[model samples]
Target chain A: MSLSPLAIVLLAVTLLLGVGFYGLLVARNLIKLIVVLQILAKAAMLAFVAAGYGQEHMGLAQSMVAMVIVADTVVAVIALALAVQVRRHYGTLDVRKLTTLRG
Target chain B: MALWTSSLHPFLWLIVIPVLASPVVYLAGRLAGAALARWLALIALIVTCAPCVLAAQELAANGAATFTLGLVQLQFDGLSLLLAGLALGLGTSVTLFSNAYMRGETGEEKYYAALLAMIGVMVGLGCANDLFNLWVWFEAMAVSSYMLVAFYRDQPASLEAGVKYLVQSAAGSVLVLLGIAAVFGATGQLSLASIADSVRQAGATQATSAGLLAAGALMTVGFGVKAALVPLHTWLPDAHSQAPSGISAMLSGVVIEAGLIALLRAVSALLGEGDAVARFGQLLLLFAALNMMLGNLLALKQTQVKRMLAFSSLSHMGYMLLGFGVAAYTGQSAAAQGGMFHMLSHGLMKGLAFLAAGALLYTLYVAKGAHGPLMVNDLNGAARRYPLAALALGVAVLGLAGLPPLVGFMSKWQIFVGGFQAGDTLVALLVIFAALNSVLSLAYYAPLVNAMYRREPSHAVRLGAAMPPTMIVPLVVMSILVIALGVWPTLIAWLTEPAGQALLAGW
Candidate 1:
């Protein structure tokens, strides 16, 4: 059976989101976790484009994606800097070990 | 009578002024010093507020007006002005206080920059006429505040908190983007008016209702993460406790409230009294009840004064959500008004409390030349040494606990009355629980007040070390407004009613 473009895009989103969330939940390395988060963001960005592909909405969707790209990049840059700081402070990039602030 | 010459609109200026001026404030701080940066940011915020004040005047004199530029649309109505006033007004106060609180601290120029930038972004979110623009402004606020949270990045705790805040909020942003994409997909509209129109047109259609429900759920979760609602609030304690007190004030006072405003705007605009909207509202009521119950219960266990305040902030958000949830569920304008009013007053009182927390820590640093996590016990007998700081803290605590003669009591009272007026027994019961939660909150806050006045000197506090006038001035100003708004409830009602009407008009 041939699938619609919406179905294809949604299937891809589910796959990417499933993987990203799995990594976010299971990844021990902070850097890898951030990378997974980026994948999740990419999925959303992709959805924005796919939702607007058919009609006269492509340009607006593309511009929105571009803006979201800039925002995601800023988050990445800061996340990387924070990762470095975390590594320096905790002596590891391990999420399991980064538990200093507790009740 | 003529504040607008066609080119000038307060909604545009409210967002534009701070955003364009943030880098200049940073540069000024760099050139002259943190002190100058502080004054410049204060001036920038006050200047930014001029448009809102003018807009309010114009609205009073003429009537409600709408302005649009490209993708951005804003209402120069009472709601936007009230939120803008709180943001810029508190922004000015917080900036003034930070200069003295962060005296001689490194990277302060950047702090002023990020702080000022956040004010602009939040103001943008306030007046943002479209859901897409709202998400963009909200994300900008999140990113700037991430930097502010890690202002002390060298400290491991601060960096950790910053990272946690960034990661969680970034995820939430992605969800918000997805929700917007879904909204645009289903309705083919992004503007608030258009979205509302489309949803109204497609009322009761299975495909349309499904998409709206999904969008509502996704957006609610997204904004809930940012608003520090019960389940998604793990990041807030760390972020608030680690950020310098000046930043903490903004984070607790306005940022979360901004998230609430955006959520309410989206729900009001897009969901438009559909079955889906009512379902969403029910879910929100459930979340609000949980937020109020568990938020206060959890806050009781936090020892770090700032973290405790952070949890208290979470609990207050629950109360605000209770009002909003009731409004959405019952479509009551009064409930919406109460929710918005709660947002404004909470911003004022919590800003005061967090600023006082900063000053107490600063006083400790002054006496001992160092500081660490500020505990409630750390503030013991501080009244003897720093009477003003202790008194400020005491007043903030009482106000937060819903003591009368303060803005907090008036807002809380209205929130419940609005809930009961929703004419739903469950909502009325929830409001009663919320009222009891207020009393429950006083349990934790009371000891802190007593500690300030009744306890002996546990930690050494300086008797005379040249108190920082910059910090004290802002505290005094905020305290006066807190009481001023309380005594003159009509002033706030004048603002809240029109805003409530704007949202109610959607229904």
Candidate 2:
């Protein structure tokens, strides 16, 4: 079946979400987790843009996606900074061992 | 044309000030210490807030104002005005408190910069009428807050909290993006007003209903995490407790409210069909009820003052959710009005509570000259030691516990009445249960009050030097507002009514 643009976009989003979730759930390292999150955030923005693709005006989706990207970049920088701190303080980036508070 | 012109006037400034202020704060940080940063942030907030008040007045006079950026049209109505006001007010108070609370602390420049950036983002979020724009502002808030949370890079707990908040918030943002995509795919529109019109035009078929339900569920989950509703609220207490007290106040106060507003916008836009409305409202009620029960019950068990306040913040979000849910079902104007009032009131009360806690911690640190780690028990005779700081805490807690003649009681009364008016007896009962929870909250809140007033200071409970004017001024101002609003709720209701009406106008 020849996929519509919308279907292609949706499929790509689903795949990104799957990969991101898998990485987030399975990754042991903080940096990997941050990477997965960034991927996930980007995928969502792509989907939002795809949603507005067929519309006559694309400014709304474009503006939103642009904003999300900016936000994602900011978050990634902060997360990396925090990760660096975590490494210095705990001597490792493993999620399981960093249990100061009981969940 | 008039609607278009009026809406653009105030909202344009609302969006501009923060984008401008972000750099101003960064520049100002170089010239002065924490004091200059605080004043700069306050001035930015005041300027931002003025536009909101003007927007409220304009909306009241002109009905609803619309501003279009390209094809996306944004509305400035009573509801947006109310939220903008709350964000500005809470943002200002937190800035003031941070000046004193964070004095002598390293990284003052970076802290104030992030704080200002976050406030600006929150203002944008409040005024945003477009869903896509709203999403951007939401992400902006998440990013800035993450930096603030992890400001004390030396502390493992702070780093942990920062990491956790970022991961969770990123997940939520992704969900929101996907939901936005789904919404666009179904209706081929990005503006909330346009989407609602399209949904109505299409007539709520099974396919459309399912699409909307899926999108709504995703958006709700995403926003719910930020609002810190139960089950999805795991990251909140740690993050709130670990951040610098000023950031904590803003996180619990303004940030959560922004999330709640986003949820409100999503629900209001999509709940056009009767069946859709009913189904979504039911889901919301379920979450709200759980949030109320679990949040307060969990709070009751926390030994740390800040952690308790964080949990209580979650519980209050539950109350707002309940109000929003009721408004969804009955379309009762009052329910929507109550929801706005609850958001504003809870923001102020929680902001005050967190700031007061911060002041106490600062005082303790100063007097004792020991900074390894502090616990709630360290405040045995805090009232005697720091009378003004203790008084601030007392007033904040009393207000939070819904004591009459305090702001908290007034907001609770509005929400309860809204629940009852909507004829949601179960929710009304839950509101009553929330009331009981507030009374029970006294168990935790009263102790701090008693420790401050009644308890004699042991040798170990050292009295700190007097709190600086910067911290004391905001606390006193907030405490006075709580009492003033409590006695006269009309001050809030007048604004909230117009805000609600604006939301319902297109409906």
Candidate 3:
């Protein structure tokens, strides 16, 4: 049997979340983590739209996505800026190398 | 009366003034230099506090006041006033301390701007009446703080801590965003009051629906990370210890509590009045137990002074959560009032502790021309040279250890009384556990005190410089308030009672 549109959208959402979370868990490169965050943010955006559509407030959902997009962009920019600093200071981009603050 | 007077929309002005003026403050610093910018930042915070005080007065005269701007709603109640006052008070003090502590540090202008932006958004978060707006404010506060955490970009530890904090906190905020979306989907509403009404009207079936339950879980875990809930607090020690001393004070003092208040506000609005409140209360008590045990036990192992204080912050959060759980379970405002009071007193105690530690470190830097983390051993005979800072540190440590005649003891007593008043076996047991944890904290705290007062001067302290007036002034003021409030606990009843009622009003 073929899935309905909502089912297909939900399947996509779950798949994105699983992949994003898996990436976050396994990714060691700083840039890779940033990419993973974007993926997870995309999953959240899709969930918001699906939620809005389910509640018949597509306008509100779309507006929320817009705001999230803006906020997520800022987060990504800052994370990248921080990554550059991390690389410059430590001469590495591996997350495992970030242990100087460990007690 | 002028239509545009701050009294008319005092809470609104509290949010607007600092945010709009932050960039201006930065520009002023860039043009005129750090000194002028420092004054502007202090002035901006004080100006922001004017509206906060006005909001408190309006709240006192008229009970809770709500100001609406389209979909956004701002509420000024006892709870909002408490949070706003804590933010502005700590914000101003930290700025003052930074004037002395952050001297010779690079990027002073950006630091002031980020600090102002942080205080602005935290006030906004405290007063937000709409759930989505609350999350937005939370995100803004987190973003600004991330910058502050990474302020020393040239330092590897600072950068590492900043990146880790950013990644983890960003992940948490995304989870919160998803939870908010799920909540909106379930309720078709966004404001806390509207959502509360919708959930209450829908009855048990809709309230217990998978979607809503998932939303609740998501928000809990999301806010839990920021709140330093156990198993999710791995990032706190590093971030708190590595950041500049003033921001450390802000983080340990108010930022984490802000997360808990957001959790309480969001969850209370979503659960409305039901068995759900009690069930959530049970969950909070479980986290409370874990946080206290783990926080204090780990703190006992810390050799670094700020790191130990960081872990102590985790345990203090546990005590506050104890107050919250009892309040939620018993449906009594007294326990919640205790929680709010603990937030106030803990802010003073922890802020003092961190700032005093910072003062000692600053002295060491100035005298020895050495810089890095300050180990507990570095405090040897510190009291002789820096008597005021050491005294302030003593007050902070004893107060946090729950010694009598200090605000910490009074606040903890209120929480314990709140638990006993519940008369529930489980909550009472939890309170006892929390009490034991307070004593456990002293095992670590006493050493720092001993190192400062009893041991001979370490190399760092022998040639340390005197602390400036800007830093000393805040320390003295906070110490006086801590002792004054402890002596007359009734003085804060005005703040605590209404704050407790505000928490319960959502129900």
Worst 10 residues of 2 chain B by lDDT: B366-375
Q: Per-residue lDDT for A1-103 in model 2, tens only?
A: 9998877987888899999989988998999999999889878887877777855446767766787787778778878878888999989999777678543
The TM-score that candidate 2 achieves is: 0.92
lDDT digits (tens) for residues B1-507 of candidate 1: 233455766568887888988999889878887778877887888787667778778877877767766665766666666677778888888888887777677888888888888988887787777888889889999989988898886788888898889888988888888888888777778898889887777654787667777788788888888988778888998998899998899889998888877877886676766565666678778888888888788778877889889989988998888877887788877788888788888998999999988888877763355658888887778888778887888788788888989888998888888889988898899999999999999889988888777547774453324458888998887888888888887777767887777666766
> Could you arrange the candidates by DockQ from highest to lowest?
3, 1, 2
Query: Best-fitting candidate, measured by TM-score?
Result: 3
Q: State the lDDT of candidate 2 residue by residue for B171-262, as single tens digits.
A: 88788878877777677666788788878887767866776778888898898889887788888988998888888888898888888778
- lDDT for B332 in candidate 2 is 69
The candidate maximizing DockQ is 3
Better of 1 and 3 by TM-score: 3
Q: lDDT by residue for model 3 over B1-507, one digit each (tens)?
A: 343343457778887888987999889988988888888999998888778777888888899888766576788787788888898999999999999787667788889999998988998898888878888899999999998988878778888889988998888888888888888877778898888887878764644456778888888988888898987888899999889999999999999989998988887888767688888888888888988999899999999899999999989888888898888888867788888899999999999999999988888873355568899888899988888899999999899999978899999999999999998998989898889898888899998899999657998788778778898999999988888888888788887888888997876
Better of 2 and 3 by lDDT: 3
- lDDT (CA) for every model shown? 0.82, 0.78, 0.87
Q: lDDT for model 2, please.
A: 0.78
Segments of candidate 1 deviating more than 4 angstroms:
A54-56, B1-6, B62-64, B366-369, B462-466
